[model samples]
Target: MVLPPLRRLLRTAAWLLLFAALGALGLLLVRAFEARGKPDLMPWHRIVLAQELSADTLDARSTWADVLAREQQVFDDLHAQLAAAAVPGEFRYERGSRIGARAGERDGNRSFESMPAEPRGGVLLLHGLTDSPYSMHALATIYERAGFAVIAPRLPGHGTVPAALLDVRWQDWSAVVRIAMRELRARVGADAPIHIVGYSTGGALALDYALDALDDARLPAPQQVVLVSPMIGLRPFASLSRWLPLYGRFDYFEKSNWIDILPEFNPYKYNSFPANGALQSYLLTARLRGRIATRAAGGNLARLPPLLAFQSVLDSTVSSADVVHALFDRLPANGSELVLVDVNRASLLAPMLRSAAAGQIDVLRGTKPRAYRLDIIGNLRADTLDVGEQRYDPGSRVPVERPLRLAFPSDVYSLSHVALPFPCDDPLYGTTPRADEDYGIRLGTLVLRGERGALQVSAEQLQRLTCNPFFTYLEERVDAVLR
Candidate 1:
């Protein structure tokens, strides 16, 4: 007997899906084999730091002192492991080296706290994934000088070794956030306001914490939320990262565990990224999307504190549109604001930019009315390098333009996701690194000219904007809020 047309169509569709899945799997396997040619795995990549808190051991009731003691143990253990391996002097894990993770009194790799003689309030600074508390150190100092006690915690699976990222879960990071908040609250008391400044992955955690606070009164809610290049969503293909690392299936595919196993040259941040790190970030974003939708649907978001977020119009790692549509769009009209840094329209390289990159600001500022204030930092005129702000208040299409003292550097074309939190005078990733401060390498100021594919680092990595030229303006805006 002949099958019905509907049944035949369903059968054909299933077979097509199966073929697509197999094709994708085959491509992944081919890529896995290609990854074998990468640089040999060092001790930092293969040796997972044993002292970093596992998900099962992390406790919400843990105090700030407890966290620091645990971190010290982690460092001690890391040093012991590396000393035994006798890692090369050039490596970051080499003990007593200037570029090593534990170099000075104020080691950026470790969690730290700063307080004034008498604190007015407290602020918790959260760094991004694969980043140490060092990323937040500058901002933390700024906040502390502004009279707020600052606590910057080293999240689990970071600031130790790249191998630590392989075993980390998103929940472990979230637990650290809760514990840090508890200590921050205790320091400032219930009466003084609490605030959070989260960069990249930390931005997602900040938002997640606020959403949780809405439902649970036991958690202290932040008075204000500030985000810098937040990870609202990533590329769709990132979800497939979970399955790419099948190293356990065969010893031959050990290198497949890592997405990019680069030299650990950056003192504070891990250069090597594991497949599991991407998987955890994807899982966190997935959970965040669900929580955001649920809170918005239940009309519970209005209870959340006002949010101020900074986003670059052109970012390769995270989706900029999702920052607006996913989180900002769902936010209540409680004085939330989004500051978008547009590409340097007046740069000489304007002719080289893709049409999509040039028109990204216009696309982000779509026709729909927004509940939050939208500010675009861009060229004041098509011919001028001087920058200005075009402020669009809630529910308004027309903007009030104000001239800013800032001007885009002639050579710089745009800001990057990692550039927002750093100043032009930063020691590590700055255009004009400070004479007094040094991190052994100045990544932001390097200018190299050579044939493509001649260097271990890609041309794209070298060319990507590493420091924010307008960081002074960013600092002023943040100070205004905290003060």
Candidate 2:
């Protein structure tokens, strides 16, 4: 039996909880209503072109030919539907437009193979969510030049409309990775080495595949797994996104399905982000975290392959600490390495950094014993922008400092989540786009100065650094791994 005063307090608390729930619902509806006046939904958002394959179809039995056929059908439908239904606009869906997907490589949005005569090995390149095979194009060239046959696959539901993300499951993505791995294994044969290079969500997929390979002998394990800004974990809010889409099931609240409905400006990537996309990512990472824990507890992770990961110290997209605590800390004494691109401490903006952000390097360099090597790339001193590498070997706190012929650009405060993959001379997102190649639009070259309400996208999105200044260093490190 409860006391009378306690019962009264409990009743009041229940009422307050109900009111808070109601308030949140009201706010969501208000935002949905406001989105109705933003921009009309394009054909790409509404149409699902390649509707043939299911998660069941994307299994070990499936061939790369089948995936390519489905991809071809998708692009065909996209070209036809957009040409007929889509109006001539400045957006990417416009047919034959400069910024359109069709204006680029004939097969830019699909899975592609780069073969070198008498290849030494094979490489499987997987891109991020909402990003097409074009994201791996530059890296493919690097591997190809080094005499490796490269297979960069456009993951299921990606390189197409943002609406396609709504129906796709993380399992479908995993199956696709398996199929691609089999293809690369076949191409390179049984003796030759095979590697996986994953960026963002692809990084999660790569690591998950590696973990699965530990238990399953049928799977082909990678020689080395390379990750860039891997999605090892997501914020707590992403898990809650699953419930918000309940209202979106109704036609009246369709706008609520999208987190952002920005114009599809980039040809290779989706500007608009959907609620299901976030939900799927959270589910994938959550399951991955659990798998890592289970494997570590069982000591099955000892056989796991060496992993080489590159991450920014302050990433806006994924949790950097999760990379350290969840994955790296649990590893065995394999030759795994983590390269953290630290903030430009010599920058004038250094003083403006948040207290937590400023202290991140110290947190990463804690006295705890680590199983893997840790390398931090940043300023050597507070007074100069000259960069150097600080190498911390396994179980060692003392760092061996090596000066590099590199320096942070005076204007750049830090590298971003999206910047580590591409070189400075990249045609699409380079600070100085190559004069030879044209991708219709050079996003990295834009320096806009206008009023706040002038653009649909935020000013911050345009101002974010898109390409890496230290890409040469990244390339050399990867090349050394290949050698």
Candidate 3:
């Protein structure tokens, strides 16, 4: 009887334990699903419409007024969602306004401008693949404040719906840049200088514009170029497509380990880009990179403009090495300058960092600045390892050893890829600084205070109030250049 009782008790305990374990696992799975399945605030529809407008392919019946109305609807929907989620208030806007728009008589192209024009020439801002002109807004604002007129054009197949991005070709993006450049020239006058600035895939397009198409007498060439974390190469583990031998397909892959590690700075974190769209982007980048490299090597130095490329040492999506190699190494001797901005730990710890990397933060630090003069043909060697592997290694550090030498004869300039977009605090709706706490307001108040302002808050005081990694990097770069 005692033995039977003991066996029954033991059996019951095991069943209970198993049930508890299963319940815990179920809860975990639910949490994971929730995290992965959160509805994107920026839906695919908006991106597609924006892209259509950029490409000039949308039906004539689809006017900017229609597009703006749809965008308003999308914004309202997103605002409700963000509000419910307790996002910041300053970050929310019902309609994004255009700072300037001009109708030109030449091509009859109407150029829409978003940022104020600065005397330091103009910058054409291009957003990343599967992203809208929204991504460039913050950066454009920064450039505007820095005294550069910013033109952030909606790429083909973006700013409407996600599906449209699938139909867009690399040429579509290139075409928009070309048009935007012409518009910039027309707006600023034919002799005025201009620079092209691109984020992610847009960076590649900027280079392609400078190297391939801008040389024609009809188009004005860029004086300087700024690339922000340019996407030169995709993750190596992406599958190869059967239809396209060279294309890397990432359709089924959602949430890679690298993305999980970084902070989420991107507003479109919830969006899912199509696999084919990604593949197309990869193919285009690869092709353009090759072409620029060839042009740089042939001593055709006059064809390319001075370039500035910035890459996050810890960026998960794009290969920094390929970008440096293609643009920095292939340029003409004494024609281009490359600035590498290493994202330090303090900078990577921002709330948005988690979106870009997995939960863990990787800080990139460099001791000595490497300079390259004229040796464009010398092969630039970069460690072709996954950024994750490098981060995980206890002793490994960000590799900035390879000097960017120009092999071709072009006036190409490359800067540290990440600093082109001056960083700012991205507060969702309710969380941004209060009206009284606004930086601009505070600055104005300080100016009014005069003696008190000098005693209490200096220029540095205002800068510290912004307190962002991107801003810090900008201050440093500006100081270095001025010095």
Candidate 4:
């Protein structure tokens, strides 16, 4: 009897060992297949490779001007190497409307300053990760024209090149936000109310900074906050993203460092995304969540400013559920509001969409007597494409719905995370571009019809809506609050 039991135990151990070995083999094979060729080097990659990677770190810069100069050098180096190799539509260092690199021309990426002698108020805008100040241009322009002294600082790793993302950390980004805010506050004294507008990842930093101000008295406090598709919570993939850099440590898997190493096509945004970007975002969001929780528990939540956030319900980058549950739920009734954009119902994919998506309207706004306002922009009649706003007022029991006179185009199914900040007439990402200025290629209007796998970019990326049809309504809503 003893011998029989021992044999069974031995057999179970052998099977477990076999399964573990198979799992290891499968993971190695997946890694090997992920990045087949030696990926093309970005401009900053080539320059940084020539020296210690620390040379690319942004912590050394003492002033924003120093930041601009270092960025210019990177662009100058990129131009020298790839100007001849670049095509007209592609983003070349010399020709691309690079945020801060036009040494002789208007550099949109450089820190912008529009200050009046007697400013009504002040606004500091922070662009998203891997994005330059141009991402914040339309919003910045709107606030500047509204008599607010506007200052938009280009985040260190950004506004220069894609490879700059390789060595930076979340702490570096938070440090820059502090610097930019101090500069803005100095320009507009204590009597002026200040606002911080963060788009995407910048949203995480803005929230983190505001939480820090609650305890650390040195930090400047914003009168209110505005976030666009804020990275309040990221995908579960982020926890795995940090492991990618470790996998890339081996000579066999260096290409794993990048999530999507693609052609630099868009002028304002980096086409290529790095694993480190995801890693830092994870850290920032985790940190922000913890601080918010701590504040809520200590009864310190009253210090937070009124926040206005705009998010696409179907964001590929962040968890929309977290926006409602994590950030907005913890607030202490300070007039915060969340504006949610629903997907287009007219698209054929609407049927295929998970039923839970439409349910988010009710799910995000639990029972009334809630502190925050929830606004859902979608089609009231499921079969029709006409867009309308369903506003659930704070502390009210019933939701009020109204028609906005805006309708989704037949081909457009949803607004993407990057689409909310851009208007339909935006020169770069617009559907019906105003064409006030040319950026050589019109990315917004590209309607390519071809066989699958023939194009350089994935069909899904091309199919994603790049501009918002109801941007006018968004602007009006924002202006109403500011006025």
TM-scores for every predicted model: 0.95, 0.93, 0.53, 0.86
Instruction: Compose the digit string of candidate 1's lDDT tens values, residues 1-483.
Output: 657998899999999999999998888888789878878888888886777875578766677687788889998998788889875566577655567433354778888888777889999999999999989977887788878989998999998899999889999889889989998898888899999989999999999998888879989899999999998899897898898886435768888888888877788899899999999999999899888988888888888899989999999988998898889888889999999999998999998999999999988999888899999999999899999999999999899999999999999899998999988888888888887777777788888887888877777987788888888878887887886
> Candidate 2 lDDT, tens digit per residue, 1-483?
999999999999999999999998888778677656657666777777665455787766789888888878877887677778867766677754677443344556788897777888999998998888887877787788789989998888888788888778888888888888998988888988999999999999999999888878899889889999999987778887776666777777787787788888787899988888898899999999999999888887988889999999888889998998899999999999999998998999999988898889888777897899999999999889999999999999899999989999998999998888988888888889997777578888889887898999999898889898988888888888889
All models, RMSD in angstroms: 2.0, 2.5, 16.1, 4.5
Worst 10 residues of 4 by lDDT: 47-56
Local accuracy of candidate 3 as per-residue lDDT tens digits, 1-483: 569889999999999999997886666445444434433333222333331433455332444344445435544554464344453332111123111111231110122364354355677888777666655655566556666666776665554334455456877677667766766666666665687878888887887787755467766788776666777776663333212211212322222111112211223321344545666677877788677656656777555665555554445567766666555655654435444433332322333444444221222222222332211111132221111111111122333333332221111111223324534343311113234222212211222233444432234322222212334443344333222
On a 0 to 100 scale, what is the lDDT of residue 260 in model 2?
A: 81
The TM-score leader among the candidates is: 1
In model 1, residue pairs whose N, Cα or C atoms come closer than 3 Å (at least 3 residues apart or on different chains), thus clashing, are none
List the pairs of residues colliding in candidate 4: 99-109, 100-109
Instruction: Using lDDT, give the best candidate's number.
Output: 1
| lDDT (tens digit, per residue) of candidate 4 on 1-483 | 569889999999999999997886677558655764646655544334122122235452445555546556655655565665453433545344342233454565556768887898899898998888887878877787778998887776776567778777888777778777777787889778889999999899888888777777766799889999999999898877776665666656767777887766676777788889899899889888888887788889997889999998888888887888888888888889889988888777787778886566667667746688888898867888898988887777687999988888777777889898889888778988885566656678988787888866787887677788888877887786688
**Alpha-carbon error at 307 in model 1, in Å?**
0.4
lDDT of each: 0.87, 0.85, 0.47, 0.77
Model 1 stretches astray by more than 4 angstroms: 1-18, 94-98, 101-103
Query: Residue 117 of candidate 4: its Cα lDDT?
Result: 76
The reply for model 2, stretches above 4 Å from the true place, is 1-31, 34-38, 50-52, 100-106
Model 1 residue 24 lDDT score = 83
Candidate 4 wrongly placed segments (more than 4 Å): 1-33, 37-45, 49-105, 347-349
User: What 10-residue stretch in candidate 1 is worst by lDDT?
Assistant: 96-105
